[model samples]
Target: MKIPGLSFSLKRAVGITSAKQKIARATGIPTTKQGLERKIGGAILNAVIGRKRKK
Candidate 1:
């Protein structure tokens, strides 16, 4: 149940986001949904479009 003026997050209380961020930074990977989607989408687009090669 949620009450007005009351906001609580168990993940935030346990520092899950900070831990995930640290892991992502150490591995050079994304730990968030949007970030992962963006990375994958960019890769797909590049594959479809192809990169220009030097002459």
Candidate 2:
């Protein structure tokens, strides 16, 4: 699944617990079972804006 507002890799970076509880507890994204897929999508967006481009 795609935890909204956070990417899979970013989630792992913050904490690789994988458990929804830990993800929420650490990142405080939210524990609700909703459009979590957005996580990666959100992360991707953030990275695009925030992360530096590699060349």
Candidate 3:
């Protein structure tokens, strides 16, 4: 019998996560929400700091 709260990830079982990580690393792009948020936050911080420094 299957558990009510159990789940399975076919992608993880098939190695898709590794492939995505490889592609993200090679292309300098993020494959996850946290990564994308971090990248965007860094860029925004840099832009604001750069403007302050230029003034």
Candidate achieving the largest TM-score: 3
Per-candidate TM-score against the hidden true structure: 0.64, 0.28, 0.68
Pairing residues by index, what is the TM-score of model 2?
0.28
Give the range where candidate 2 is weakest over 10 consecutive residues by summed lDDT: 31-40
lDDT of 2 by residue, 1-55 (tens): 7777975467666664467776787885766656466566677877789974443
- Total clashes in model 2, counting residue pairs 3 or more apart in sequence or in different chains: 8
lDDT of 1 by residue, 1-55 (tens): 7799999889989999789989999997898889899778877877888973333
Candidate 1's C-alpha runs over 4 A off are: 1-6, 52-55
Q: Give the clashing residue pairs of candidate 1, or none.
A: none
Report the error of model 3 at residue 8, Å: 5.9
lDDT of each: 0.84, 0.67, 0.87
| Clashes per candidate, residues 3 or more apart or on different chains | 0, 8, 0
Evaluated at residue 54, the lDDT of candidate 2 is 45
Task: For model 1, give the 10-residue run with minimal summed lDDT.
Answer: 46-55
Off by over 4 Å in 2: 1-34, 51-55
Question: After aligning candidate 3 to the native by TM-score, how far in Å is the CA of 28 from where it should be?
Answer: 1.3
